[model samples]
Target: MRCLVRERNKTRIGVTALATLAVVASGTAVVTAPEAAASFPRGEWNETAYRGQVEVIPAKDDRSDRRVLRGKVFVDRDRDSVSDPGERGLRGVMVSNGRDVVTTDARGYYELPAYDNMTVFVTQPAGYQVPVDEYNIAQFYYHHLPQGSPELRYGGIAPTGPLPEAVNFPLVESRATHTKDQNCVIAGDLQTYDKTEVEYARKGAINDLAQRHDYTGCGVLFVGDIVGDDLSLYPDVKDLTKSLNGPVRFLPGNHDLDYDARTPEHSFDTFRAQLAPAYYSYDVGRVHVVALNTVRYPCTPDVDNPDGKRPGCDDPENKPTYNGRLDERQLEWLRKDLAKVPRNKLVVIASHIGLVNYADEGSPVHQVDQVREVYDLLKGRKAVAVSGHSHSIENMKTGDLAKGWSDLFGLKGLPFPHITAGAISGDWYSGQMTEDGYPIAVGRDGGRPGVVTLEIEGNRFRERYTVTGQSDRFQTQLGLNTPTYRDWYEARQEWNANPEGPAPELGDPHVVSRDDLAGTTWLTTNFWMGSTGSRVKVSIDGGPARWATRTQQMRGEDQNVGPEWSDPHAVAQQLVHGGSVADRSMHLWRFALPEDLAVGTHRAEVTAIDSYGRRFTDALTFEVVEQR
Candidate 1:
């Protein structure tokens, strides 16, 4: 992986210094008169060259200085921080710090009295998507100064003082939907980097969802990587998600960061401003959905290289300090959130990164490091975690957190399944193009570039994948395996490297074996099992038959730039490499015939059992050609 390099034209986009004060007598309230507000500060308010000794002090017993609040507003019209003339003084916009609201003056700006600990946010109007950063992370809201406010149990602004002056809010054309439904859809990554990629996402997946109306019970949940970079594409994304026949919710991925963020506190400010929540829980039917920001951005400064060669890279200083860990603050809030949820509610913890190993071989940054802790928190309670970022499908079910060491983290196997919702883009923009003129980016797993539906009926939910306009059978694919096919597989690699593009041709598996098991187990399978008794076990003549290992880990490390983040899947494949194709010791199994009795021909069959114990079998018969 390449290190993130800073471009030469790096300039600050928007920076507004705001002073907010909220002063009120105990059990008393403050109100502004509608008509008498004529004398209040109006138009773009600027405290030119104001510095130091600023505090939100309580007003003394003198019944004076109550006319208006003094403050300043900075406009970032062009969105690059250096406040220019044309970009300044945006008028007629309304600004509110949670409680009170005020409209801007004719000069495209306004000023309001300061209030203590108010969360200043604009009511994003229709037709526009908020400006985000290169990572598609939103850019809105002013950071609360003086650090921590009186913390609320569930998190909101504290009633500290009066509101700030010139508390300006930025607005854009939004294609937002205000829908209230019970049928829900869960979508994974829509990580489009540019216009072409955005079109790929729109045509490949969004176009497919556009025709879909069968959302199970609620709207849709897009679980992160909304854009690879180029936050400008967000408006289009908002339009795409709006195409869905439901409400859309979002989470953040590692790629969705403001690389320009000056502090750790401001890291997800843009994301929170646009997406609404970082680690919040909402309810629908008998189910509760908790969206989390597992990518705990590092706040500490870069100390490893004083020369600053690795300025913006996620180096030792910038690496996500806590993997899969909910910071003490978020954890505390989560506990409170869960308290409001009943024990029997079907809870779905939706995150951008999977709780455990993503697709067996894991990507360090995309899989939560502290999966066990998250698992243990939900132990005994019926729960499932749906994640994206690996761009592959891996449905893991290990049975309970008590197993000690988790298959992905340090906990034991889980009591529920942890799913990596396959990506909408798929393979990071690679592979063959389809008839639709888009790459067949959907993973080899049964997953396709569409959406997942969860039919919630009380506490129990049923899940299914809608592969564009195709039927269930079309959504899944099975591989054929045969001896003659094995011969062709061996010749496929070397033939490509020759100067002459003319390479060896692979024979038809159907013609080679006449055995039904020809394409059965050459690679892997996405069983897409429901939450029940699904089991996949294979044995050759009563001997152990292991599943094939994926050739690539699905994600790579930027080790060329920083310290390696360990992944369990990569470590597993490395430990078990290089053995005979027939060796049972190999993690990936390949069978060789038993020499003594097999001279003429032989037969082998593999079986698969679903949750209800329903079985499907495939068999193959091949000649044991005698060695001359």
Candidate 2:
């Protein structure tokens, strides 16, 4: 991935309208508009109605000379990318060269020092909009890799020898961006390793995206792992984006790296060329999104240290190593980027490796190395982070804590929301294939393959998860966790991998005896997106509802793992079919059974209320039989 650079100057310069027609170079395209008087007269500034022309001049003789990339942030009145005669420029619009951010002048012109591997993009300012391609993918940036990338397995950017004189960005008036309320889809890993998995993604989440139109302005942000390790599947990824109903943005995951590249500089050359910048920021409504590149590959040991111990790849030239980290350059850019954003606006930070996770709870390698630094940067702001490397769904609220985080980083509690959006390619496309031709890749935490949506109202936000091939009402999975179920869980693990007989069954989900209740019997509910503010209540046999306690309290306690904490509903499917073991989670809740209950059939009504106060109800039946 490309590094974020510093801006040379914030002062904007005015370019005189060309009296003569400039010849465009071969393989170059020029877009121009009739010169109009500057909307904002000298000494007076209007945020809107600023006007300018977009001119493309031929390259000069010096191939090595780095030129300044000058462009106009014009208002595309007709919604066409080309700046027409009636269209005007937008002043104070932020533009960046993958690093430094500069505002458009009164005339709407912006210039930044250009480099070989920079991507110059205009941040979608509030009340303004950028053009979307045929696939509803935002087309706001211009990649400036004049000579393209070095030779690789999957082709990187093709050669574009000289820089164009004008790299204009067009925007139209948009009320959707100014509205207080908005819906933004945040999807996690679409780790499709091959063509079949690509189809799974298409039928699964991509199909879901096509059916939804609510998220128009903020759109969908796939938080990394767009494809599996195979970079050649990028075309298929592009094809999948076409199914989306709104603008689609992406971040890069460890699997998306170009493994063949020797240096970290070119690790994501193909990704940058085909998808988006390694790191960037944008705005919609009162929310500012800061997409970060947190994966550092070929992580070598510090040879200078006295400790002889080393981790990851010792010789990266032969085999690759990956870790969750942000280079110093990205951190600097983040500081500068946040400086421009208002403190009151809600900041949604997106990254591939999460700041913290339950999946890789104790492993420091799977979590971001600079968690404290990032938190310190956004100290007082209303911020939330969304990430997707671990393939599990998690919604950690403010003040929540995990034992791993405390033990590794000395962090006592979370200061803001940190959600790990569940993977789209659930459990790496494992398990039995569904009727829809996709695998029922239930995650390790019992979270079904799905996407997370953030419903934002000004500076406050509420998050919800939508499981693939299911309705919004499908929020929780209910199961009976008893001694019998625990025995079945163990037996299935021992025999299911290589079965000598019929697979071990989980018996009847609704039948339990006094002996079963005498042991460890309880009602378990896996609230897929449950967080601190959420609650789960159970009402047995039309009695008063009693709140079910969350198994893992994010109060600095160690994670409660193993079969006792596993979601029996997930275990049933995973053990019988095939997939990752659902051994632990941060969202599972349980209520103990009443030992004094009379012998009879019992009906339990479960109600789960999310952090947003939205309620979902499900029912389960079990028999409390008399001892033989």
Candidate 3:
């Protein structure tokens, strides 16, 4: 048997390196040992810093300051963000000031106590749509940053001197958002680092979105990694969103951070100025989408290293790092947000770093640090989580487990569904070019690049992944895995990456020998969007269908990982063509070939059924030979 060896350091992509450590309140230095530090990995958390003492700045009380902002939710006939005289007010619309939620009166007029740095937004009412900016990003809220940001790069919210008499929000009536059946577009990392990559995205997923009109109301919620470190590309991202059919909303990923900012309050200031609020909630049909800020900068002090080589709390302003965590403020806001939502409503939590993922299945640092706390808050509520940043597509059903989560977070199983929406810039836009002029940037799990759409009917939802430029039925890839395939997988990884001589060739993916069957041979399937409650069945030579076992059971066992768990189809492509390794996957299924089968050509028909009971079928033909 050939084993695929992966370099640990290179395995993790899109995560930033650890910068420094900080001092704790007890005057002890926080550090991480060199050996243990490697386990922490980089890229996931970057630019985080630690401090001996963190000052809790109380949110300003607008009422105490004798301030009240009035606004009218008007029906914008023109669909422009600006309110006009001909437009009529939309009564009964909900509005908020991050804490209080109120409904508009008969005249569509409402008042809220507004304070400095508070975002006052209107809850996009069912049937009425909010106006979008040039980037097609919904402009439902008006940020009030009285004094602007305190000394920061990229310039935070501009100074808005005094509270205006009114801050009106405009909306347009739309049949798309009124019905219970809605399609919400969920796209993961569009981590375009440069303009060239931006063009690549324009031609790829963005182009696909432009051609489709399904998600017009619920709109597109890009779950983090909107851009690679270059905040300047936000405008370009906005421009790309213009091609989308729905109003766009964005959650800030670690890469979207203001790295030069000194404090948590100012971490996403630049993001707020350009895109949507750092974290907020909106309603569409029966679903309440709560976009949370999970990337915490200048994470808790590490207590094992003292060379000051790592970013630390003493000089946090200069050395910053990031971690997947939810601050007290955001959690408090979440509590308030959920309070307004009905008990039976389906709560969709959106963030950049995932609550849990298979890509970093055993890494506590990559998953949300406060997962238990968040889960506890959502107790008894029907909920689902969607995130990006891991660059891989994951559909973790209720009760899924990983050793890291159980060991670090004490989480034995998932309470609800958590889906990591695959990246649009798959594998950082790596690998060979395609006829469509984009790279076949397959993910680490071997899932192809795509965007996930949640088709909702009332509180129940079904997820469907649409690979860029492909139909919805293109759900899985099938291949044969044998000793030869494994050996070729390993050899090709080194050869394709750095050509040493004539490239190694994999044998016909269809043919298998008796020796191959004797050694170890199996049929593998990469179900890009498969999740818990999903099943795969295979029928050989038109015979009775037999169930194929899911590799990672997600039933509190340690993650079933490594090359043995790799996706044979994706491994074949990535190893030879050059891209992220396709070793270890959450959605891979395998079926052992019958060793006593007659030597001849046989066809295998496979069917994959999702949690929603939707079935996708595919067929493959292979040969059972006596010998090579």
Best lDDT among the predictions, by candidate number:
2
Q: Encode model 3's per-residue lDDT on 1-628: one tens digit a residue.
A: 0001112222221113212323221111222122223333232111110101111111233333547777678775543233445668877777887666677888788988777777777777777666554345666666667677777667666664455446666666767678888999999999999999999999999999887877877989999989998898887987787566667888899998888777777788778877877888888888888898888776545521232322343445566677777877677777767777788888999999998887786665578867888899899999999999888989888888877777767887899999999999999999888899999988898888889999899999888899987988999999888877877777887786688889989878788989888878888988988877889999999899999999888776776655568888777778766678888888989999888878999999999998878899999999989987
Give the lowest summed-lDDT range of ten residues in model 2.
Answer: 1-10
Q: Which residue pairs in model 2 clash with each other?
A: 50-89
Worst 10 residues of 1 by lDDT: 578-587
Question: What order do you get sorting by lDDT, best first?
Answer: 2, 3, 1
lDDT of the structure predicted as candidate 1: 0.46
* Per-residue lDDT of model 2, residues 1-628, tens digit only: 1111111231222233221223222222222211222211222111222222222333444466856888788886654344445568889888888667888999788999888877778788987666654334566676677677778677666665677656677777877777888898999999999999999999998898778878877889988899888998987887887656566788899989988777667788788766777888888999998889988776655521113222664667776677788877678778878888889999999999999987887877799878999999999999999999999999999999888898877898898999999999989999888899899898999989999999999989989899999999999999899888898899889896678988778777668878888996889999989989899999999999999999988898887888899998888888877788899999999999887777888889999998878999999987877653
TM-score of 2: 0.88
Better of 2 and 3 by lDDT: 2
Report the candidate with higher TM-score, 2 versus 3.
2
Off by over 4 Å in 1: 1-182, 299-324, 360-364, 398-408, 442-447, 482-532, 535-609, 612-628
User: Could you tell me every candidate's TM-score relative to the true structure?
Assistant: 0.56, 0.88, 0.83
Q: Rate the local accuracy (lDDT) of all candidates.
A: 0.46, 0.78, 0.75
Candidate 2 contains a number of clashing pairs equal to 1
